[model samples]
Target chain A: MARHAQKWRDAPALNSGDEVNKASQSMEARVINPRSALLSNYEVLSLLQELEADHLARTKIAHRIKKEEEAAGTDVSVPIGGGRPSTAVETLENLRTVSFEAIKYLSADHQSTTSQTPEAVTELVKSLESYGFTKAEKLQIVNLAPQEQIELYVIVEELEDRLSQEQMVEVAEHVKKSLAAAPSLSIVAQPSHKPLIVKADENWDATDDVDEEFDDQGEGAGVEGDLDMEED
Target chain B: MFNLAILKDTVAVHPADFGTPQELAIMTELNKKYANRVLHDVGLCICVFDLTEAGEGKVRYGDGFLWYKVVFRMLVFRPFQTEVLLAKVMSSDHNGVRLSLDFFDDIYVPIHYLPVPNAFDPNERAHFWHASGDAEAKQTELLDTPVTERMWIDKGEIVRVRVEGDEFYDDEPGPVKMAEGVQVVKEVQTRAPFTIFASMAEQGLGPVSWWATAQPEDGEEQDEIMEDG
Candidate 1:
């Protein structure tokens, strides 16, 4: 058994020299602090948006430069100052693709982020200071504008133990109020078409009876009110 | 969910990038190395947040590239355990559900983690909840139930899932194999380096539409229950 163990160790020892050489040749990146700070979805979205815009601007400049060179009758196929000119562009493209994917993922079905501003988020955070929620919980509450108590419960662990039902309701109310204060472009854009369609449908149905038409108009107004509330 | 991770790396900037600003060049090099890549145990790195420290550039004996040790904060997509996140259902099977956040598509809700009393329907190629009043109801009771009566977690539906855990697998190099006298490097099926385990068993989870439509009624029921309790 000892002889077998000795051979096994010897086999690995031979390969260790090669492994060390490879390790020294390529310096591996090290993680200093894995959890330095948490970033909200809104913050990430904005950062990605900025990166996307920068990529677009860079691409435009590169395109313009290429055009100028082509017009000047220079050999445009060959890169002008060639120290792997393609690498920079390739890296930029990769960044753009990744950022675009992340932005799409972050923004999809997340209407709260559309109108979320730093000021509004800070104000909301300040209002929820009394609850003594953790930073992660607060970030989540801000990211997902929890409209109901059930949604709020999912964000904050041990919800019943931490806060009473009334407190939960109050927190939800605070979130709703803060979200409402922010001017929502989607809410504004949403109502215009729905009410118009309802009105158009009512006109088609109640053309003959005047009294029924008035009643239908009142029903349409109620529907419009419900639609508006839902948008909020 | 995202977080800032401070990472240190030695970045070698090529002589070509010397014309650009030092910070810009370093930033570009860092992004090239880290962006869209998964760091074992750390998470998927998105981009460098900011450069915190940069050591003096060193000239190697032969290489023209200037190397600088950089310490920077990187924005990474690492959802915390039990954190609530909204993701779209990519597909469902006997195993459970697969979810996608567009950029990260390896999120999975295993069969055990799905809402209790849930079963996979082979006909629909999707898993669905029985939605029966009794949590203890058997699978046989749901067999005769109409399709509309069942709450289906269909594809393309947005769901709220709580992060249960995560896994990181290292794809280490394996020994080459010989097949029919020709040495064949085995075609290892590439797996996601980082995968998230999520659960949708709690209240307000599952498809967003499920709660969206039933929210008012659900709230009223909860209020009644609270009062009774």
Candidate 2:
């Protein structure tokens, strides 16, 4: 109970501070450097999860306190100032909403974040060091976990010129291994978009050889797809 | 997708908050001011990362609040140009497709940025790509295929897109005026402060299901052999 009281008291003096800053024109906030560092999706996801857990705990404690006050016959419904909630309460609510939305977005099925861990991600980075990929390219590779050479081509520019076919295959294998080693957590319900099943003989022409190569590396993903089909 | 931005702000701490630690009080004040808000060009601010420096507090003549100049780092949601990202389709129209990251929903993939030979189906209210039987020729030409064969980018489907650009609008509130005898309330136009432009024209960048691994003929043959055995 004492801890819960401290949480509300921790709300800053935003109302008065804003008023002061508005009155003094010279005190306007400014950006020093817009891009000081880059943060990966995993970093942001873990941080938000921590913040959300804390917010939920505090909310539950606050609700219990309100119920107790009501049982004691104290009127707890009165607003602190006339009929308006305090700015502190409003700020906390804003934080809760923003964090919740961000978490949902990051945990979407398209993102491979749920199966990623700090150790696996770090190891993947170390293994990718030899490829000499740009920072942005490396980040995207880690974020997407592309299983096929074509998918890697999308993230890494000029794939044909930069790396040979064998090297590309090796990179995809590394990503697959890392992802497999990590424990998977289903954060969001997977969208029930049925797999587009293409008959093997329907389009078996010169393109079949190329697709066979893609299928070879993505065998792990193919097995998973088969499992989903079986369940259905 | 997230960048750390360093910003400087003058924080005013009231006497009522003096009981708390100095840094905690200042951090609370900063978060209240910046969290979940969009800066003009920096992108959407998420939350404060850490404080770098805080100058000595100064007291004003009239107000009892102490003001301090603080420099801090904050997390900002700003994807780089040409960066590939995954987003869910929010809606579709003649204009194009609107995407959402859930928190930030002002993403638009213009019609031209979509794959070529695409047509908007008013009846279904979604766009369909006229894919050809030949995988190589699908992007260049439209084949006269049946409706069931075409690829439809329906609502709620996840798609991979490349970030093309971003726009920021500085919309300041206009001054209020009294007209004639009645006080006319001016209708304010609400626009997103920041919007991202994305594209899905490239290969390996479309619906996730489209790129799902194709089962090899050899694997299927192996299954048939096992059944016979």
Candidate 3:
């Protein structure tokens, strides 16, 4: 009779153990399989939010870089061929400035027999153009002296004998004087163009008055002419 | 075909052991062309040698003395030709020089390149050309003459050779091959280190120095020594 009572107690314990096992298996199954659509939606939403936040951060970084560049006034756009623009006004200015500097150093003292003042040279250029001289001949005349300019004019007019005898003699004398002057100026202005015009100002006379004082002070020592030219 | 080194009929070699007659001839010609030549400008001749050997003691990667040799066969011979022009002496001294060329170029020969004349005659045109700047020249013509030349030059003197195989002293050498219709002129002016330095100190551009008539202390010392003697 006691044994039968013990068996009854054991049977209830066994039944409880089976029930616990069943509950555990149900929990495992729920975890392994997605039973509800709500959890999936929550996970997907979380992932999308993370990606959006990363994208926003990257965009903010790019915007900040752009803003900083704008503030500094830097043109960061790459050219088609990765070359600096050739049409820059600064480059043209630099070239003109250099040319002007070269012209400035040219001096009358440095002039050779072939050298002429800037004004004389310009006049010769105009004359040569009017006479329809060859480009090379015109260029050569422009680089010549006042005397040479006269000679070239006569020679071009003569066309190797077209000019009158008087013109020929006059031109020849001018050429001789120019040739004689060549040695003096050539020695001083070696490798330099002659009759260098440093400054071109219509109001140069006003400043030239002051320049005489400057010359007396030896400030304009190597200048072409002093105040005496003004007295003339 | 020629033997690279002629033997005195002293040795006998099997036909298989000796190099071919053509090979020997090639070696002989190469040796004759390159034997005494020195490595001039490695930087300018980079196309001939490996780029890695520049500035290093090694001339070429393959053989000895290969880098020192200039292949003269590849060069063209343009004869010495120039038009001589008469020019008047403006002003010249040991320090600076200015002369006109065809009234076109007023070439300024500064102190360093002023060709000093050892001896000259005032009446002689060549002598005048040589000694115009020298104070010793009592008289000089006052005129401009033009000169032209196509040839090798050394120390401002025209050399007899039509083609210069090596321009070792030039700061910049001419083109390797002067193509037809293309003429690129190269000029090099050498100045004393002190002069260059002084010019730089005074102005950005190289201008002639201001003339000072008084002699320096060194000149005074020489004068005193002369007096004592």
Candidate 4:
């Protein structure tokens, strides 16, 4: 009991230190003021401590609710954090860190050895995402073991293959009709958009002179018309 | 330009005792043994025939024996090559540069070994390769595309190389397969930038320095954390 209490004490210190360090590093990257930047580390650590406490409290509450549900001999509709109850598998995944012992718990619950691997769970989640599964649905799938992942992979693969086969037939029909009407020539030549005739330098010079004279005459007429209108 | 007596003695002496005085002291020994003999240069090539026994030492070449091969004016001596990782850089002092290698061997590289007109700055990190000189583009690809500009350890620079993955060598240990989400395209040349970690940790080739990433002093300073842990 003493050793267990000591472990709990050490956990808070190490976790807080890591959290503070990571937060400080991230803040130091963006904060410009030297004084404010130093204080940010303290603020981040305080926030982390609060979050850790809250998480502990929530876990305790969840444990109590689960125990009540088990005693009641009915499906426990205990809302896990604002939503449905999380399975044992989901709870393990939320830890982020790989727990090698997670396989045993999953095998016991699922009664299937194949559904208890991290790889299987990851694959299952990926497949669920591909199948347009909601975030919560994907999360549920992600909480599974390797066996579950394999099952999800197989199911997703079969569905995708069927959908693609149907789409391919439709695409083939569309392409066939479109090509039949596409003007078929013996050579299948594309018409050139570039001008064939190149203008001579003399013609360019003449055009430039005419444009300059026309601009000058138009300006003179505009000024004369403005003068006449003002006099009237 | 050639010393006839020295040349004759070198050829007469056995290669096994290539560095001994018997092979080198031909002129001095000749004078001491027989003062009345007169010697003349017989062109560049002189065949000295000994009256008694062909000379106590003659030349031979084998392993552990130093043999001189005359290629034009230069003499070539074969030296063994060993590959070692840059383990640690000892503090720089006026005495010279010292290095501890992963092979548990420490060596002091004198100023002469350092290439003159060093292109890298004092603060800039450098990388060192087992093979020196400019790197040949052995292979290239546009995969994983570096998120930022990349730098590497040039030859002779002290840099960090993570040992989590396989060690870098010329030969492949397993069949090379394209990684996930990567495709090999033909007729297209690839040139992708790589981070220091990718080069050393993933590719298994480097002692790449991370000085540019805002933690230059942390290279040696991390020892404190390690000690605490």
- Model 3: CA > 4 A from native: A1-105, A110-120, A130-132, A146-232, B1-229
Best by lDDT: 1
Task: List where candidate 1 sits over 4 angstroms from the true fold.
Answer: A1-26, A73-81, A84-91, A184-232, B178-181, B187-189, B213-229
Grade the docking of candidate 4.
incorrect
Chain A only: TM-score per candidate: 0.61, 0.61, 0.23, 0.21
Candidate 3 C-alpha lDDT tens digits along A1-232: 9999999999989987886675454323111111111111112222222222222332232333445556779746333556432111111222223222222222323333224333343444564454455544443333333242232442243344555666546544543443443332222222222111111111122224334432333223224443122221
Better-scoring candidate (DockQ), 3 or 4? 3
Clashing pairs in 2: none
User: Best candidate per TM-score, number?
Assistant: 1
Each candidate's DockQ? 0.31, 0.28, 0.01, 0.01
**Candidate ranking (DockQ, best to worst):** 1, 2, 3, 4
In the range B146-176, model 4's lDDT, one tens digit per residue, is 3122232333444332222122122223444
Candidate 3 residues B1-229, lDDT tens each? 0001111111112222122232222223332332222223211100000011112122222233222111111110111111111222344443443443221123334443332322222223222233223434332322122121100011222111111121334344545545586765545575211111011111111111101111212334433432432
Count of backbone collisions within predicted model 3: 28
Chain B superposition TM-score per model: 0.88, 0.84, 0.18, 0.20
**Model 2 lDDT per residue over A53-107, tens place:** 3333323333334455567786444555454211112135455567778888888
Off by over 4 Å in 2: A1-26, A58-91, A184-232, B133-145, B181-189, B214-229
Model number with the top DockQ = 1
Q: Sort by lDDT, best first: what order?
A: 1, 2, 4, 3
Q: Which scores greater on lDDT, model 1 or model 3?
A: 1
Residue lDDT tens for model 2, B1-229? 8999999998998775564457766876887888788898899988777788999988876788989899998889999999989998899998899999998999999988987668677777887666544544443243345565567777888888999999998888766677987777878888889999999888877666556553222334433432432
lDDT of 3 at A192: 22
